[model samples]
Target chain A: MGELLPLMLQGAWVTLQITFWASLLAIACAVLGALGRLSPFAPLRWFSITYIEVFRGTSLLVQLFWLYFVLPMPPFHVELSAFSVAVLGLGLHIGAYGAEVMRGAIRSVAPGQYEASLALNMTPLTRFRRIILPQALLAAIPPGTNLLIELLKNTSLVSLITLSDLAFRARQLDQATFMTLEIFGLTLVLYFLMAQAINLAMRLVERRLGRGRIKGGLA
Target chain B: MSMQQRFDDSPMVRPSRRDGSAEPLVRFDQVTKRYGSLTVLDQLNLEVSPGEKVAIIGPSGSGKSTLLRALMTLETIDDGVIEVDGEPLTHMPTAGGHLIPANARHQRRIRGRIGMVFQSFNLFPHMNALQNVIEAPVQVLGMSKAEASQRGEELLAMVGLEDKLGHYPAQLSGGQQQRVAIARALAMRPKVMLFDEVTSALDPELCGEVLNVIRQLGEAHNLTMLMVTHQMGFAREFADRVCFFYKGRIHEQGTPEELFGNPREERTQAFLSAVNEAH
Candidate 1:
């Protein structure tokens, strides 16, 4: 039991590291994708749409496999470590979903904000940065938290690519000791706790952003 | 013909040189606007002199609000030119004397001279009254935070919102929000202020408060003011001139006394009588 505990803890550490790095990457991708989608340039809008649709349309497992195997074998000749591939696959997959959420949030901002900024003679960049983005960030966070937790769960798929995540450790321990119920049950609890932690952190951010903001008004 | 040259060229007309004389501050010359089949403004030719207070009154869809909006550049006109302080606003003049639709830079240059208050009171909901007032001055005009804040407080106080400095738009009453909107516009120090039915969305009791602030502005400020309004009595008292609009044209215009008391046009007479009966 003690030996199994140590292995599971190590696996959990790997899982946490993947989630942390992947979340950062996902946030960057989501922001860029959202802005690109909304951009005035036709090519940028189309590229964003393509990236989002392709990632969201395909299976995450297949994406991970492609990144891990296919990229190194063809004319592309791109090579990456298993951990890097895992991060890229999870980040890109969840980021596509986050992009849609962010796009919707950005569009949901009242047209009056744009008009008021225009009346103020603010530049387009200034209007988006100062007025639109902050408001959109507030709208995006709840759904973003959901996507983050989904990314965490999706990390389990990386075990197939040789990343020893918690799911991988749990399976190995269950097969070696025939302790499937206890090991798998604990893995589920750990994942649930990690997801809850993410939810709590996002809620705190939501409250901070919401400070002094007029919400759900006649506006 | 290059895009770079188009954007880089200086405006043919410089900043206004009006010294508050008989010079027209805002001129709409044969300006036409249409929304699909509906003609919003048809060859609308109107001139407002420096420091003049003009009120446009008309029934719904008579193009009164559109007139104010066109001045604010909120609604683009289909043809003709809008000049602010002798400078082209809707069109930029080339060296060859041809008018082209003004580029973004040109539009922005002219836009800075005008401020507008909407019927809905578009105060930024994310910001407090003071923040809303300070944002543009600090961001667009490059005023230091300290200078903008001081000016912002003064503007808010001028609008009688001294106590509500920290209140968000949602926290303030409709009249209070409109007053804050006025202060926000005033902070920009615009040469022209357009009020588009600013009091229409307010309660009857609340309407007086917003109008009072505007009345005070009319008396105190030297800005060229244009108002699109439904308040006949307030217009009679506050406006230097009243232009009655009908079917995308100024049907009649004169001093408020003459326009309201001895309306020359049959349409003006009918509109005034109908309004008087309603009140």
Candidate 2:
């Protein structure tokens, strides 16, 4: 148990790194995808819909496998590290879902807001940045927190892609010590603690944003 | 009968005879608007001179609101030109003698000179009353924060919301929120103001306060104002010219004495009677 603890901590570190990177990538994709969907240009809207559908329709495991295994072959030959592939796979998968959440939030903002901004003669960019986006961000936070927690859970899948995440370490330690029950139990607790941390961080953000408006609860 | 005689005998609001050569502040030159198969406003021709207060009263679906919305550029028209301050707002003229739909940049540039207050009091819920008034000035007009805040305080005070500057729209009463909306619109110093039933959403008791503010603005300010209102008394008292719209056209328009005191059209008489019954 003493020797395995150190190895498990190292694996946890990798899990944290992957979650952090993947979360950032997911947010970027979500924002771009949402903007594209709302854009007036037909080609941009089409490209965005295609990207969201292709990522969301397929299986995450297959996507990770393709990124890690298939791309290295002759025709594509676009090799990536296991860590990068894990980030790309998880980020793109969750991002497709998050895009709809983002679009819905933006649309949920009252039509009166757009008209008021127009009456004030605000430029489109100024209206989005100053009026529309801030209100939409508050609306998006609840669903966004859910997506982020899901992203954290999905990091466990990176182990199958040869990434030494916490799940990977748990399996390795169980086989070595033959204390499968104790190792797996500890792993479950570890994942719970990580999720709790995310909840705490997101709650603080929600509180800060919920100051001016009335709707969202503190929890 | 004697009260009616007295109202008719009182001096009417004289129409402004501004510089004879100056263009009207707003002109809807044969404007036609549509929504799919429905024609919202059909070949609507109207004019508003600077410092003139025009009240539009009509039954529901008579295209009264659309007329103001068209001037605000909130709705697009299918044909005809909407000119503000003698310049086209809905279209821009090309060098080859053609009129094309104005782009967003051009629309915004023209729309800046007009301010609109909605029936719902469309104040930004996220911002306090003061911030709502200052937002346009600081962002669109590029006024310094200090300057905008100073002007914002003055506008809020004008609307009798001096103490509620820090309150969000939700915290204020409907009447107070509408007043804030007025302040927010006025902050832009628009050459023309459009009020689309600004007091319709307020309680009956609350309506007086908003109307009072508008009355004061009408008496003191030189801005051109167009109000689509259901308040018959306020319309009679405040407007220089009262237009009774029916079926997408001004069925009858004249001085308040001429229209409200003695409407010539049968539709106008029916509409006014129905409104008076509700009142």
Candidate 3:
């Protein structure tokens, strides 16, 4: 039991790193995908739709296997390390769902805000930056937090690609010790704790965004 | 010929110089706007001098709001042109001196001289009163933060909201929100201001505060004002001329005393009596 602790902790650390890096990448992809989907240009919109549908409609595990297994073959000799593949696969998968969330939030901004920005003579870029984006973000955060938690959970899938994440480490420890219950139970608690941490951080962010306004108790 | 050539070739009715009056600050030259088959503004022609105050009053869907909206460039007019300070708004002059549909850049530059207040008092919800007032100056006009804040403070004080600068739109009452919106518009130092039912959304008690601020603005600034209002008493006192609109056209217009006291047209009389009865 005591030896199981150190190995599990090491696995948890790798899992945390993957979640943190993948989340950053996911946010960038979501913003780009959402804006591209809403863009006036037809080619960009089509590309965004295709990216979203292909990733979201397909299985995330298959997508991960393809990145890790298939890419190093002939014709498409793209080689990446296991860690890079893990982050890229999880980020792209969650980003497709986040894009739809962001698009809906942007569209939900009241027409009056656009009109007011127009009356103030703001350029399209300035209007989005100063007025539209801030309001849209407020509406996006709740749904975005959900997508992020799913991203955190999805990091467990990287164990199959030879990455020593929490799930992978627990299995390895259980095989060596033949004590499945103790190691697997601890792994479950660690994941729940990490998810709770995400919820706490998101609540703080919602509070910051909602400062100076009447508290609606949305969280 | 294209519609552009036909409009350009038509004889221009230049204002008479013999009268010694100044050129009109804003002109609508046979402007027509339609939403599908329904015409909202039917061949509308109106002029406003540099310092004039014109009140537009009409029943619902009579194009009273649409008139101000077209001038603000919120609604596109189907035919004819709108001009501000002797420059065409809906159309731009080419190198050959022919008029063509104005682009976004042209519209933005021309409409910079105008500001509009909506019926809903659409203040930015995320910003406090002071931020709302100074946002346009800092972002759009490229004014320095210090300079814009000073201007914003003065405008808020002028509108009797100095103490509430830190309050968000949700925290402020409807009247205070409207006043903040007014300050926001005035911070741009617009030459023309359009008030589209500015007090319509306020409670009856709250409307007095907003109307008082507007009255003070009229006395303090050299602004050309167009107000679409339901408040007949305020129009009577504040407007230089009152236009009674019916069915997308100005059916009658005159000084407040002439129009309100002795409306010549029967439709005007009927509308006034109906409004009077509602009160």
Candidate 4:
């Protein structure tokens, strides 16, 4: 039991790194995908729809396997490490879901806001950056928090690709020591703690974004 | 002056055209706008001088709001040309003296001289009152933040919201929000200001506060103003000219006394009587 602690903590560190890097990549993809979906140009709109449908419609595990197993063969001879494959696969998968969330939030802004921005002679870029994006982001945060927690849990899937994540370490320790209850229970607590951390961070962000409209709250 | 010569000179070099003497500041020449089969504005021809106050009154769906929306570039006119300050709004002039559809850049440049306030008081919900007022000045006009903040404070003070500078739109009353909206529009220093039923959304008591601010503005500034309103009593006192619109055209127009006191057209009389009964 004492020996299992250090290995599990090391595995947890790997899990944390994957979650951090993949989330950054996911955010980038989500913003690009959402804006592309709403773009006026036809080709960009089509591309966004295709990317979203393809990533979201297929199984996420198969996506991981394809990036890890299939890409290094024949016509598409691209090679990557197990960590890169895990981050790319998880980021792309979660990004498709985040894109829809962002698009709905962007559309939910009142038409009058756009008209007010136009009346002020705001350039399209300034209007989005200043007026539209801030309002849309406020609407996006609650749902976005859910997607992020899912991404953190999904990091367990990286174990299958030979990465030594928390889940991988638990299985190895379980086989070696045959103490399933002790190791797995501790693993659950660690995962829960990390998820709660994400929840707290997102709530703080939502409060900051909504500070202007909320009365009697900290400015 | 020949049309070509007028086009050749810079827009700033043009003479100040005011009140039945020089050229009109705003002209809608046979302007037509249609939303599908419904003709919202039917070949509307109107002229406004540089410092005139025109009140547009009509029943719902009479195209009064549509007329203001067209001038503000919120709605595209289906045909004819709308000109502001001796330049085309819906079209751009080429060096060869041809008029083509105005692009986004051209429209922005032309519409920069105009401002509008909506009945809904569409202030940005996430920004405080002073932020809303100074947003365009800092972003669009490239004014420094300090200078824009100074102007924003003064404008908010003018609208009687000096104490509520940090309040967001959700924190303010309907009338207070509309005043902030007015201050936001005025911060741009537009030559023409369009008010589209600005007081209709407020309660009767609140309407007095907003109307008083507008009356002060009219007395203090030489701005050319156009208001589409349902308030006949306010129009009678505030407007230089009152236009009665019916079925996408100005049915009759005259001084407020001539039009409201003795409406010549039967439609105008019926509309006024109907409006008077509502109050």
Instruction: Provide chain B's TM-score, model 1.
Output: 0.92
Per-residue alpha-carbon lDDT of model 2 for B1-279, expressed as tens digits? 332353356453224356653347788898898888888788888888778899999988989999988888888888889998667898987878588888887888889889999998888877888999999999998999999999999999999999999988878888999999999999998889999999988999999999999998888788889999999999999999999988788889999999999988899999999998986
Candidate 3 residue-wise lDDT at B3: 28
Over A1-219, each residue of candidate 4 has an lDDT whose tens digit, in order, gives: 789899999999999899888888887788789999999999999999999999999988899999998999978999999999999999999999999998998999889899999999999999999998888888888898899899999999999999999999999999999999999999999899988988898889888778667554321
Angstrom error at residue B138, model 2: 2.6
Give per-residue CA lDDT, model 3, range A47-158, as digits (tens).
Answer: 9999999999999999999999999998789999999999999999999998898899889888888988999999989998888887787788889999989998999899
- Cα lDDT for residue B202, candidate 4: 91
Q: What's the best-to-worst order under DockQ?
A: 1, 4, 3, 2
DockQ winner: 1
Give a tens-digit lDDT track for model 4, residues B1-279: 443465467564565445427567789999899989999899999999778999999988989999999999999999999999878998998989899999999999988989999999999988999999999999999999999999999999999999999998888888999999999999999989999999988998999999999999999998889999988888999999999999999999999999999999999999989888887
List the candidate numbers ranked by lDDT, top first: 4, 3, 1, 2
When superposed on Cα atoms, how far off is each prediction in RMSD?
4.7, 6.8, 4.9, 3.3
DockQ of each: 0.58, 0.40, 0.51, 0.54
- Worst lDDT window (10 residues) for model 4 chain B? B11-20
Better of 3 and 4 by lDDT: 4
* Candidate number that wins on TM-score, 2 or 4: 4
**Model 4 complex DockQ against the native:** 0.54
Error of 2 at B60 (Å): 0.7
Better of 2 and 3 by lDDT: 3
Q: What is the interface RMSD of each candidate, in Å?
A: 1.6, 4.2, 3.6, 4.1
* Chain B TM-score (each prediction, in order): 0.92, 0.91, 0.94, 0.94
